[model samples]
Target: MGILNVTPDSFSDGGRYTDVDAAIEHGMDLYRAGADIVDIGGESTRPGAARVDAATEVSRVVPVISGLAAAGVPMSIDTTRAAVASAALAAGASVINDVSGGLADPAMAGVARDAGCPWILMHWRGHSRDMAQLAVYRDVVAEVCTELLARVENATAGGVDPGQIILDPGLGFAKTAEHNWALSRRLDVLVDLGFPVLFGASLKTYLGRLLAGPDGTPRPVDRRADATLATSVLAVAAGAWGVRVHDVAATVDALAVWRATGSPRLAKP
Candidate 1:
């Protein structure tokens, strides 16, 4: 999967693709660069960011989704609102990447159930604006797993097929750098839940902090591609189902190398 943010305030790559034409072009570029699917989000879920109204989100994503759909690029609607997801699906999106994990909106499960498309349920405690305060976790991995399982139960009970469900650990949202690293280190536990796990650590703040300079300033977003690539490779090695990334070509190249090496088994059998 490739990441494409159509909002002006996403932590990284924001404002760069807010224009409809530019967003479409970038979506196509991701597809051409070997992305199996392009995940397009209209809202900025970066920490402390304000939420955009549903109408605005729908307006931002639908046109780009329509354009990309017309050009034959497979796309996923990265939203928590059922209305926005429905509009994008009508505009040609085939998947729902809900960071809220169907918790934000009561209607989201119904939308996913009706669409019968893949529904990615990310582990989220709250919206971006208040998420920082909600990051408190005694055992990050265990709590995340329990929370994700509850989400899975909700999704299944809400009539979405189990086969269509995908799980994401919600790396930066409401998670400290230590929490993010802990989840990454034990990603296979999430994978073992019998659902396809989607790892999305592309240009996240945790990686920036991990690569901070001497002055303690975090590494710039653009400079974190190598770290992102390393995470992608390692995630796949750890049995993650897919990785959502911004530098699609680099990740694709690295994975190709991993594949060429007979795709050696790294996860415990």
Candidate 2:
């Protein structure tokens, strides 16, 4: 999967694709560069980012989604609003990647159920504005697993088909670097839950912080591609069903190497 953030403040690559034409071009570029799916998000979900009204978000993403869909690019609607999801689906989006996990909008599950498309329920404690404070957890992996399971149950009860549900551990949302690492190490736990796990660790802040300078300043987003590729290949080795990424070509190459090797381990013991 490739990420297409059509918002003005999405931590990285925000204003880069806000224009409808530009967003469509980028989505096409991602597809040409070997992306299986392009995740187009209208609102910025960065920490402390303010929310956009549903109408505004819908306007921002619909034209781009429509254009991409017209061009035969598979797309996923990255949103928390049911209205926006519905509009995007109408515009030809095939999947709904809800960061809120049906917690923010009660109408989301209904939209997914009605569409019968895949709904990605990311493990989220709250919205971006207050999610940092909600990162607290006694056992991060266990708590995330429990919460995601609850989301699955709730979504099913709300009419979404069990087979259409995809789980995302939500690497950066409401999670500290340590929490992200813990979840990465225990992805097996999530994989064993009988749901497809979507890993979205591409060019995120945690990778930047982990590859910081000697003075402890985090690396810039452009410099995080290498780290993203590492995480992408490792996630595949660890049994992730798919990885949402920004640099699809590099990851595709890495996965090619991983497949050619026929051994997941890059180093011999």
Candidate 3:
């Protein structure tokens, strides 16, 4: 999956694709670079970011999705609102990537069910504005897995087809750098939960912090693409079903190398 943030305040690549034409061109670039799917998000979910009204979100993503879909590029609607997902689907989006994991809106599950498209349920504790406060976790891995399972259960009960559901660990949503690393290392726990797992660590704050300078300034977002590729390769090697990334071509090349190495099985800890 390739990420296309069409908002003005996403942590990375914000304001770069807010224009419909630019967003569509970027989607085409991702598709031509080997992305299996291009995920277009309108609202910025970065911590403390103000919410974008549902109407604005729909307006931002639908045209781009429509353009991409018309060009034969597979697309996913990255949103929390059922209304936005419904609109995007009508515009030819075939998947719903909800970072809220059905917790934010009561109608999201119904949208997924009626659309009969894949739904990505990311592990989330709260809205981005206050999610950092909810990051408290004793055993991050075990807790995340358990919570994700509960989400899956609720989604299925809400009428979403079990086979159409996918799970994402939601790397930077509400997690600290430590928690993100811990979850990344133990992703097998989530993958073992009988659903496809999506790892989305592309250009996240944690990677920037990890690559911080001696003076402690975080690495810039553009500089994090190489680290993102490393995580993508590792995640795929560890059995992730997919990875959402900004640098699609780099990730594609990295995965190709890993596959050329016979796709060696990652060792158990």
lDDT of each: 0.94, 0.92, 0.93
Which 10-residue window in model 1 sums to the lowest lDDT? Answer: 260-269
**If scored against the real structure, what TM-score would every candidate get?**
0.98, 0.97, 0.98
Report backbone clashes per prediction.
0, 0, 0
Question: What would the per-residue lDDT of candidate 3 be over residues 1-269, giving only the tens digit for each residue?
Answer: 99999999998888999999999999999999999999999999998999979999999999999999999999999999999999999999999999999999979999999988999999999998899999999999999989998998999999989999999999987899999999889888888888999999999899999999999999998899889999999898888999999999989998988999896657768
- The order of the candidates by lDDT, greatest first, is 1, 3, 2
Question: By TM-score, who's the top model here?
Answer: 3
C-alpha lDDT of residue 183 in model 2: 92
- TM-score-superior candidate, 2 or 3: 3
Summarize candidate 1's per-residue lDDT along 1-269 as a digit string, tens digits: 99999999988887999999999999999999999999999999989889999999999999999999999999999999999999999999999999999999979999999999999999999998899999999999899999999998999899999999999999988999999999999998888889999999999888899999999999999899999999999999998999999999999999999989987647563
- The segments of candidate 1 whose C-alpha lies over 4 angstroms from its true place after superposition are none
1 against 3, candidate with superior TM-score: 3
Candidate 3 runs further than 4 Å off = none
TM-score, structure 1 vs. true: 0.98
Error of 3 at 29 (Å): 0.5
